[model samples]
Target: MQATQADFTVLFRLLSGVVVLPLAELARAFPDEKLDSDAEDAWQSWLERFAARVSAEAREPELRVAEMKAANPKYIPRNWILFEAYDAAERGDYAPIHGLLAMLSRPYDEQPEMEDAYFRQSPSWARSTGGLAFMS
Candidate 1:
């Protein structure tokens, strides 16, 4: 099922035990007139309904850490990292490519140093910048 901001808010509240009112309600409770809007209210209602539907599903299966880690890798190469590696290879520097290969070799193992460099979403600058960023 498609996820939405309201669904995330509800799930967060359920897991964290924090009350997160809808933005529209928050806008009403707080004196921020700018934050309150008809559009936001409509969106909030839609999200609440979606969240309700999702919450009605049976509880998810709980897996042990080892089993979970085996099913889900600790690292998956991000597009921007691949782009950087490819770009460096084009410029006669193959270190990035080799490093990426090493990381991929043991995908389930936690590589702390590489986490900050390789496992992440594309940076804002790389988005729609064209070339390898868009290609890969």
Candidate 2:
């Protein structure tokens, strides 16, 4: 639920500058778990109210996203990443490790190129993957 909230919060702030993104759109956050209908409705109703209140007094969209990203990092070395890095290392490929290092070097910065590659939640398969360590 924490991950879902974080995803919703970021998206809320992202679209908050212009308009409130509907709760239906936040389904992307539920990668691992999907809320039941009652829970989903409750969250949606609550978030809609909250987003409405916030949007009424929001700053410019770009400025809002910039401030949020500046304060919160977009990248972190998650367990899945550690798994991938180590797996590559065991195969004598050190590039994943180097790439992980480079990505972590600017955790808070908006590395657009790394967005699809690194800036995302863990996939379902990650549940079975063991990692060496975690870093942020």
Candidate 3:
């Protein structure tokens, strides 16, 4: 029999409870608003349902901030940044490329300028080329 979408979602939730509880705890402690969207709510609901089935697999709560940092990324270079960097490198204007590399190394920090330019959504070119793989 084919599993329904509901069934698959249930399974995904269980997996999230196993793999993402550490990430969730990190979200709570930091009060990071990134995961507070409607999409995130759906994810949390699924996780709770899944956790119900695997009661024996409980893991001790983790330090959310550290756990999140370890598991999640703060920045990813969208295609625009990559192309920009490459162009700069070709022209020997390596400042933009190096600056981006440095910023990506510490994404969670409050760098307003970095947040404005590179930390936002993937550039339009990036989305068109790969349909938003930068989100991961």
Top candidate (TM-score): 2
Q: How high is the CA lDDT of each candidate model?
A: 0.52, 0.63, 0.50
Q: TM-score of the candidate numbered 2? A: 0.68
Q: By the TM-score metric, which is better: model 1 or model 3?
A: 1
Task: Name the runs in model 3 displaced over 4 angstroms.
Answer: 1-62, 130-136
Candidate rank order under TM-score: 2, 1, 3
1-136, model 1: which lDDT tens digit per residue? 1222122222222222212345443322121223335556665776577557546646542333345456556556656678788999999999999999999999877787876554443455565677636522
Model 3, 1-136: lDDT tens per residue?
Answer: 0211122212222233343463344232121223545646666676566556445445444443345445545465656677778888999898998898788888555466775465443444555566333431
Model 3 TM: 0.45
Question: Which lDDT value does model 2 have at 82?
Answer: 77
Candidate 1 residue pairs in clash (backbone atoms < 3 Å): none
Mark the 10 consecutive residues where model 2 has the least summed lDDT: 127-136
Model 3 residue 78 distance off true place after TM-score fit, in angstroms: 3.7
Error of 3 at 11 (Å): 21
Highest-scoring model, lDDT = 2
Clashes of each: 0, 0, 1
